[model samples]
Target: MLTGKKTIVFGERDEISATATSACLKAAGAEVVYENTACFV
Candidate 1:
């Protein structure tokens, strides 16, 4: 389900939430390239 799209994430890395989200998004045909705890998106 990853489309391989450039993506950015900003949140507390307290759990696998971020990871899972990224994974799901990526699997959905998104090119995820970057990830951070703070991004002015």
Candidate 2:
């Protein structure tokens, strides 16, 4: 179980996975710090 820690989620243009990851992490009681999106050409 996540008690005390930090979590970060990077979308990287993947909205589906990124949102899921963020939710999961939040549910686990993690302090999400940063999120960034990167577009690749």
Candidate 3:
């Protein structure tokens, strides 16, 4: 697992991918330092 590791999650705006990704990461013991939902350019 990714325990004790810090990660940033950039979720696509108007999408669920971020939510799923963050959940998966958390389940793997990863620390989501920051989570953002935005329209990436």
CA lDDT of every candidate = 0.62, 0.69, 0.82
RMSD of 1: 5.4
Distance from true location, Cα of 3 in model 3, Å: 2.1
Clashes of 2: 0
TM-score, candidate number 2: 0.55
What is the TM-score of each predicted model, taking all chains together?
0.48, 0.55, 0.67
Ranking of all candidate structures by their TM-score, best first: 3, 2, 1
The residue-by-residue lDDT of candidate 1 on 1-41, one tens digit each, is 33545777545456445566777777788865766553334
* Clashing pairs counted in every model: 14, 0, 0
lDDT (C-alpha) at residue 8 in model 2? 68
Candidate 2 lDDT for residue 29: 86
Q: In lDDT terms, which candidate is top?
A: 3
Q: Please, what are the lDDT tens digits per residue for candidate 3 over residues 1-41?
A: 58878889988866756677889899999988888877765
Error of 3 at 31 (Å): 0.7
Q: Would you give me the overall lDDT of model 1?
A: 0.62
Global Cα RMSD, each model: 5.4, 2.5, 2.8
